[model samples]
Target: MARGEPVTVEPVVGEPAAVADLGGERALLVADVHAGIEVGLRYERGVELDSRADARRERLCDLIRETDADRLVVLGDLAHRIGAPDGDEREELAALIRAVTDRVPMTLVEGNHDAGVAEAFADELDVIGADGGVLDGTVAACHGHTWPAPALLDADVVCTGHEHPQVRLEDAVGGSRVERAWLRGDLDPAAFTEAGTEADLPDDPPELVVFPAFNERSGGTWVNVEGQSFLAPYLPAALPAADAYLLDGTRLGEYRRV
Candidate 1:
């Protein structure tokens, strides 16, 4: 495949990661890593916990090797500090970045918590705006806190994070549990008109893929739970008739109805 041709992005079964064929180079796509999350929990909520930074970094490295990805694209929130990185957070991030970049080139899409990381490690990664950037001139990747770049809206497909989407399920016995999910739908060209983007709406809109967070410690909105709301401002409204799927790839028609 070449630039402008249809790109391939397939979710890795049972994991919140995807393999994207960036023309001929494969890239691993992950989002909402929230590294050093224990630090944030300790600071913001007065909760103390052990750092899973090592496990998180190793998981990513394993994915890169297993997928044979030529590059790695972090959709957003690679760090947990909402403002700036320092202390244990900075150290963990440094190690994580080094580990991934050592294996393959990496791109970090700016999420709400990533500004400081971008500024601090500008030399180690290809840090793009939170609005997102096109990969291999085909696949579009964004953080989803805001609308994607207009050009990204015109790609073969658009993928994002920030929702950390999960669905609550109930058994016949009334036991319930939450599972992270993938939300996908057709892009509504009319949706971006309000965001003030001048994207040339394609005659046939591309698929809009909402990825789940890679960090299990990151609790997210229970999409199917009543009174729970979507985090992305443009979601639910922008993605009409969106469907939710489990990490195992079981499709539960219509995320709203799941």
Candidate 2:
């Protein structure tokens, strides 16, 4: 957790979630909870799911407790829709935020699915731009739909969640299963220079950490295949030699989306 040294990143105990312990500031980070996802499925995908709002809240609370984190940083897509949230989404998000904030402070990094989220939780939590936030001068975190702030790219490590990175593995029996996973690699320092982002570039580029979707019910892109797309504009180049890991910290080795 020293400056310019790799920060220790790991999944929360007994959860498909992760947290970064940045010496002075500890953060429990999760992404794409997508509250009211059941509603989105009901309308768009023709599937109905019983409201699991309480269950989602409980799961997050449990992770917070397990990690003993001082703060919770949701990477984005806290709600399901792209525009305004519906009554169901609002209620669900409000309940979850209230429950978590009641125990510890929370910070939300805006994402593509978070257009109206700032207003929804304006009074309860701190909302930051999608570009990202710097943590304790060591870690920079963002939602990863676009380019991160230059200052963030210069941090010791940069964490993102918009990819909801996952991997598909096939067994000898001709069966396959998908598991939520983490992607870690170094960013290409030239990307910042080429993009003209105004910041002091590090001698060695910071590492990039892509988180998995916190909600298991959500979908993810297979990251080990050819031409697989990602939401982050600087990715695939920013992280040319990324390695994939399961939520339990199982190393799946190097992967390429293209």
Candidate 3:
């Protein structure tokens, strides 16, 4: 019911979502909404396509209802545009934010793509700074485009998105497929301490959970594929022994080996 309280997280069985207990508030955790990506594709790649904003909003609203979440905690990337929103992106965000907040209060831990987003939608939702948001004092959530704030290192668990992790699985006949995945591991203190972070390292570091992108359109790093690399600066080093799991709850052991 308050900060410094206990918290727990459980990934939804087959969806890129989690039901988190931030003390007394139940929250549905998702990341990388990337609204109006259609506009981005059309302009950048000349790949015209219809917008899926309606479906995206409905899917998110349904998740909130299904999970009975009191709040919607988006780890980051609520907007697709790299800078200030305009045109279709603004329209899309307005509708999405209104729909979600109408169902449940929302928190936006601003992601890299969310430049000027908070200033644009300041009144519609709660905006946490780029350093990340601390919930229940025991859990931290950040968009993993940068090092987590020094203060977040103290939580029992730190949840992040922006890696948008995916894995390439090969079958016996040389067939292959890519699937979104969840990555988790114990935090490695060296990544921060050695990097000259300001916070004192915890004696035993907390768990680090890298969530998959909620937007399937946002292609991700092929973690198990050769030549692919992680986007986060502290990844692999910070989570040297991270394990990967498919959205269906299939554990594939070590991510690099999977």
Compared with the true structure, all predictions reach lDDT values of: 0.87, 0.81, 0.88
Candidate 1 residue lDDT tens string, 1-258: 123556667999999999988878898999999998999999999999988899999999999999999999999999997988999999999999999999899999999988689989989999889888888667888898877677876677888899999999989999999999999888786774446655577777777899999999999989887888877877777788789999998999898887
Candidate 2 Cα errors over 4 Å, as ranges? 1-5, 192-199
TM-score of 2: 0.92
Clashing pairs in model 1, backbone N/Cα/C closer than 3 A: none
Better of 2 and 3 by TM-score: 3
- Residue-level lDDT of model 2, residues 138-210, one tens digit each, is 7778887877777786578777887877788889999988778888888886663336656666667788888
For each candidate, what TM-score against the reference?
0.95, 0.92, 0.95
Q: Provide the lowest-lDDT 10-residue window in model 1.
A: 1-10
**For candidate 3, what is the TM-score?**
0.95
Q: With candidate 2 superimposed using the best TM-score fit, by how many Å does residue 60's alpha carbon deviate from the native?
A: 0.4
Off by over 4 Å in 1: 1-6, 193-196
